[model samples]
Target: MDVRISKRRTTGQMSVFELDALREAFRRSVRENNVTEVQWAEHAERFVKSMIRKESRGIQA
Candidate 1:
């Protein structure tokens, strides 16, 4: 967590129509699940712990 990493996704010169389609796809996924705020935090914590365990074992998450 101490290390900082910054990355950007740059798709070279796409049309507005193409951009709209991509944006819509992302929005759809974000709304696909209906998790409450508390549930989300719980899931997130569990995911982080799982990731740490996986890394300790040198396995892909």
Candidate 2:
């Protein structure tokens, strides 16, 4: 946890928001067994993108 380390996502790695999406997807999978792969993927994508958007909006000089 060094301040100098870059926060940017590395290639082939998941971001914190994406990881959270996975966690949510897993839970939804268990609860909604009928969910399709396409639907699940969209959910994860939306979750991560929305969180990133929200986080970026909070940044200020």
Candidate 3:
């Protein structure tokens, strides 16, 4: 699957409240998938690495 993320930059830091909300949403992702936190983190790591590799290949081409 090809997952594309836009390279848009946003200025300013998220407020504490917004940060907490994001945290809650992240936690919910794991809970909804019934995966342990460690497992979810590992999945994210692999996905990020794969994306990097794909980008590198494109650059080389």
Best by TM-score: 3
Model 3 misplacement above 4 A:
1-10, 43-61
Predicted candidate 1 versus true structure: per-residue lDDT over 1-61, tens digit per residue: 1122111113235467856875575445446655466566665566557645764585332
Best-matching candidate per lDDT: 2
Arranged by lDDT with the best first, the candidates are 2, 3, 1
**TM-score order of candidates, best first?**
3, 2, 1
Measured against the true structure, the TM-scores of the candidates, in listed sequence, are 0.36, 0.40, 0.46
Q: Residues 1-61, candidate 3: write the lDDT tens digits.
A: 2222222112334567856775675666657768776698785565457655875697566
> Number of clashes in every candidate structure?
0, 0, 0
TM-score of 2: 0.40
> Tens-digit lDDT track for model 2 on 1-61?
4332235433346668877876886667546666566577776576668766875685431
Q: How many residue pairs in model 2 have overlapping backbones?
A: 0
